[model samples]
Target: MNNLRIVVRGGGDLATGVIHRLWRAGFTPLVLECASPAAIRRQVALCEAVYAGSATVEGMTGVLIHSLSEAVAVWQADQVPVLVDETAACVNILQPEIVIDAIIAKKNLGTHIDMAPLTIALGPGFTAGMDVHAVVETKRGHNLGRVILEGSAAPNSGIPGVIAGFGKERVLHAPAAGVLHVVQDIGSVVQKGQLIAEITTADGSVVPVEATLTGIIRGMIRDGFPVTEGFKIADIDPRQEELANCFTISDKARCIAGSVLELVCAYANKA
Candidate 1:
């Protein structure tokens, strides 16, 4: 097994793909996440370990741990460890050889090239060779997953990728600032105009969140999660066959993961 220490900042769905790939390649990658991660695709996100004791995606299990010692034990057990350190204070203590910023925040959140011997970030808002050693494309299209070593990835389009003829129509956003309570389970098929969730505002007024398209619930925020107005809350897939997609890493994620794996291997070879 490879003993190189890899620390991934963020445990969301996209980040989970990178973690899974690294682990499968014989590297024990530690995930750092916020105390409360608002991951819509919770089924495949290792950040679920923060809420539950552990989260299993495909066949890899990520166990939530408290201390550095527990992280080593989890690695020995062949499972990834999720640590709640959004600010990444543990990076200094762990002294990992690789640091990956996978927060997907579309903005650089304090990640720097000097964080480790090798540093990589995903999506836009990062400059390759400036803020990080490399940047992986996250936008959907011909350039998805391309590794940028000298510049930056494509700019955020603010538009969701078209899937089954539905683009922005498939994504659901909170209409008000309040607590969201989901009415439908993920993977459940629903019709347009159907009720999907409700938000209870501070004034005790309930705002209904309905489906904008007919399809399965691809993603949804956790029930009772406080959300701000316009916050992404759920996603609907117009393809009925996408029921299984809700529980697994997406093709786009896999594409990006492959690029990340390739970069890691290249660095490892040089070492």
Candidate 2:
């Protein structure tokens, strides 16, 4: 096994794809996440382990740990370790050769190239060769997952990729800032205008979040999670029959993961 230690910042679905690919390729990867992750696609997100103690995604398991020693132990046991360190406070102690900022927050949140020998960021908020060693395109178009050596990917258009003739209609956003309560779970078929969730504002006013199109719920924020106005709370797959996709990584994610691995390996060889 290649003993390259990699630390992935974020354990969401997209990040999970990278972690899975690294582990299968014989590299040790540890995930860093916040105490409460806001992953809409919980089924394929390893960060869910933070709340469940342990979570399995596509056969690989992620165990939550508090310290570096426990994370190392989990890796020894052949499982991915997820630590609750939003700022990656353990990076100095772990000293991973590679660090990937996969938070997908659409903005740079304190990630820099000096953090590791090879640092990578996904999406447009980071500048390659400056903020990080390189950047992987996350936009869903021609350059999706392409590695950028000295620039950034396209900015987030705030529009979800088109699926089955549905674009923005496939997404559900919170109407008000408050706690979210899901009335329907993922994989459930729903019709347009059907109630999917409710947001209780600080003043106790309830706002209904309805489906914008008829489709299967491919993703949804966890119940009781705090959400901000206009925040994406759910994703509906227009191909209602393809429920299997709800539990597996998307093609976009796999492409990004492969690009990340290739970049990391190329850097390791040069070093």
Candidate 3:
């Protein structure tokens, strides 16, 4: 077997707790987090691997996407320790055989995920330095597992996609070619059918571009640069009311339709 290796996700005090447990037991760790490197510098040396991107652990059947993706890299160590994170509104978007819901509110945020009959694993409330018992329900019956909380809970996270207009505005550009099709400028109020920017070939070729939606211009292509086809011309804010509910974090719901991905793998072994 390889040396003990644990890949934990989260950048809070809760995460630190889990890290501490592993270290106290003489196991190294890897952290898959999105916070700034300087913020978690102390833990950096202790981690054998780090994925500074979002660690999405949607409940998948028999396969955790993020864990599986990092398997090769983390496995390089001795034994693949564990990758785990806690979520209030945990979801099994990947269809995990087990779904865990520890959300505080049971109203709209009910823990009952859409898909059932898999397995449900949950700790009443997971907190730093807290030890708890979890009930695991399978097709046949329930099993018991021990749960210990460490480090910070988790960042109230969200991810939002921007809707942009069609234009040469706010788009990163090539130091190459293109011409304006219409009066397109940064921070302009554009309509759905508005004409944005256009390009002409050196040999008398002309191209026409149209606006994609109605919104305020948010970005621009770099100044004095030529743009190639399919380049980002601008950024726009959608006029839809949904924008009001848009969340820019990850752990939280961007909308009611969204789900939180939390994957944890913890196995007790000897040092």
Give the candidate number with the greatest TM-score. Answer: 1
Stretches off by above 4 angstroms in model 2 are none
lDDT by residue (83-159, candidate 1, tens digit) is 99989999889899899999999999988998999999999999998899999999999999999999999989889
Higher-TM-score candidate of 2 and 3: 2
> TM-score for every candidate vs. truth?
0.99, 0.97, 0.26
TM-score order, best first, reads 1, 2, 3
Error of 2 at 122 (Å): 0.4
Off by over 4 Å in 1: none
Top of the candidates by lDDT: 1
- State candidate 2's TM-score: 0.97
- Tens-place lDDT digits, model 2, residues 101-163: 999999998889999999999998999989999999999989998999898989889888898
Model 2 lDDT, residue 148, Cα:
97
Q: How much lDDT does each candidate structure score?
A: 0.93, 0.92, 0.34
TM-score-wise, the better of 1 and 3 is 1
lDDT ranking, high to low: 1, 2, 3
Q: Candidate 3 overall Cα lDDT vs. reference?
A: 0.34
Predicted structure 3: clash tally: 41
Angstrom error at residue 184, model 3? 1.7
